[model samples]
Target: MEERLIMDLVPGLEGIPAAESAISYIDGDEGILEYRGIPIETLAVKSNFIEVAYLLIFGELPDRDEYERFKSDVTYHTRLKLKILRMMEWLPENGHPMHYLQAVTSAMGMYYPARDTLDEEVRYWSAVRLIAKLPTIVAASHRLKHGDEPIKPRNDLSFAANFYYMLFEREPLPLVERILDTMLTLHADHTMNASTFSSRVVGSTLADPYTIVSSAIGTLSGPLHGGANEEVVRMLAEIGTKENVRPYIEARLERKEKIMGIGHRVYKTRDPRGEVLKGFIEELIAHKDIDSGVFELSKEVELVVAERLTGKNLHPNVDFYSGIVFNGMGIPTDLFTPIFAMGRVAGWLAHWMEQLKTNRIYRPTQKYIGKRKEPYIPMEERKRATAR
Candidate 1:
């Protein structure tokens, strides 16, 4: 008799190897994240976002000439075409920025055709356009929604500083610019995250880079992923006073509700990204006079959460501290996830490139539990299901 194969179904595919990747790595148990074998902490502190993006996409750090060329390419392509901006003006003023980002990104494909996913030049320019214009799209969407003319990108500014300038029409202070760049580096990629996975899944189908990235942005907009930072800021605002931290936490726990940003699915200890953001938060607190109450409340919430939930290995994740950092810098709360999407786009494209190298459309098997073949009933013979 031929042997029968037995397969076990995994819910959510947890602990399942979806694909082989060389882009990024995470050791959840040890609280470590490395991109191309370099520690995240080293990259976050030493390298700028554009350089980090180049490394992630190209699989290695660039030489000085290579770095300059890549930076120039990205900077030169940062402005949206006037037609793109005109189209954006018609988007709903009350629409979520993420929706604007996704729609505009998908529409980019019509303007810059990249149907030949196998062509190197096509892939290179597509990557450049996607990376360069995401910040423009994000900032434009924000300004348009608020009834303001979108600020154009300044070619003279660094990647992070230019984004800040476009959003507020003023250059960030040196420290603020540095922190914003570091924040982008810190969020640039995480191994096989929801958005990265979405990118890979779409890329496997040989889709254009814009469509792949747009799909990933849609995935990141969900509350459980990049959207959590927005919720974290809201949670802090709701807590109001530092004294209310414990009570708010206790009540949430008592009601079996989630304390947004307090836990992560992979890390058993505090998230490494969270640790980096905490350090920056300290620096901002000492140097900047912006609202420190949110920062203080964040600390108290973390402390209370640690006191109550540490034994269960629930600790502050990246979302917990990132909002405070952005909020302190005078960023709008809704823009948090769009900024995250901006950073993670590099990773999404990196994974898209890698996926094409060993392309096989994802077709995971499912264990069926529904009824098998049944006799077809005549329309008159079939009874309507009883209403619950």
Candidate 2:
């Protein structure tokens, strides 16, 4: 006799291997993250965002000539076409930045067709254009929503510095530019994150890179994945004073509620990205002459949460300190996730490239739990049954 086989369903596919990827790695228990075999800590401190982006997408660090060429391509492509800019003007001003990002990104497919996902040239240019234009789109979204004309990207500025300039029409201070670049490197990729997973899934169908990235952007817009940084800032604001930190955390704990930014699904220990941002927060506060109230409050919350929750491996994640850093830089809270999308797009494109190599449309099996079969009644029969 032959035996039937069954598989247990895993909720959210937790701990299941979706694909064999060499793009990024995470060891939750050890609190390690790497992009293409380089430790995130090293990249965050030693490399700029563009370099890190090239490394992620190409699976190796670029030499001087390669870096210059890639950088030049990205820099040259940063400006949106006039029609795309006109389209942005018509979007509802009150919509979230992520929506603007998603719409514009998806529309890019119409303007720059990449239907041949297998063509190397098509993939290369698509990656360049998406990486280059996302910051421009994000900056434009923020400005247009506020009834302000969007600023243009400056080719002379470094990638991170240009983003800052486009957003505010002024170059970032030296330290701010460095921190923003590091933050981008830190967020460039993470293994099997929701957005990366979405990218791979969509890319499996050989979809154009723009559509793949736009799908990933939509996934990242969900609060569970990308909104924690904004929530962390809000939590700090509500705490309002160092004295309130412990009580507020305890109250939330007692009610079995989440402490925003205090935990991560993948990191059972301190998130390595959070540690890097934490150090930067300290450095920025001490040297930059900015208001440090949020930093101090964040420290208190960390201390309190550490004392109470670290036993369960619920320590602060990347969002914890990233919010403090962005808040200190005077970034509006709503732009946090959109900025996250900007960095994670590198990962999305990398995964999209990887997914095409072993393309298989994702078709996971489902366990059916609903009624198997039911006869459809004619309209008169249904009416008689209702009457009865």
Considering every candidate listed, which one attains the maximal lDDT? 2
Off by over 4 Å in 2: 1-6, 383-388
Give the alpha carbon lDDT tens digit for every residue of 1-388 in model 1.
9995649887867787888999889988888999999999899888989999999999999999999999999999999999999999999999999999999999999999999999999999999999999999999999999999999999999999999999999999898899888888889999987888899999999999999999999999998777788888888888889989999999999999998987788888768889988998777767755667778788888888879886798888888788888887889998998999889988998999999998999987789989989999999898878955
Tell me the TM-score of each prediction against the true structure.
0.96, 0.95
Q: Which segments of model 1 are wrong by more than 4 Å?
A: 1-6
lDDT of each: 0.90, 0.91
State the displacement of the C-alpha of residue 210, model 2, in Å, after optimal TM-score superposition. 0.8
Give the TM-score (vs. native) of candidate 1.
0.96
| Pairs in steric clash, model 2 | none
lDDT of 2 by residue, 1-388 (tens): 8995648888989888999999999998999999988889988888889999999999999999999999999999999999999999999999999999999999999999999999999999999999999999999999999999999899999988999998999989898899988888888998897889999999999889999999999999999888889988988999999998889989999999998888787788769999899888888779756788888888888899889876687888899888989998888899999888889999999988988888899988988889867999888767553654
What 10-residue stretch in candidate 1 is worst by lDDT? 284-293
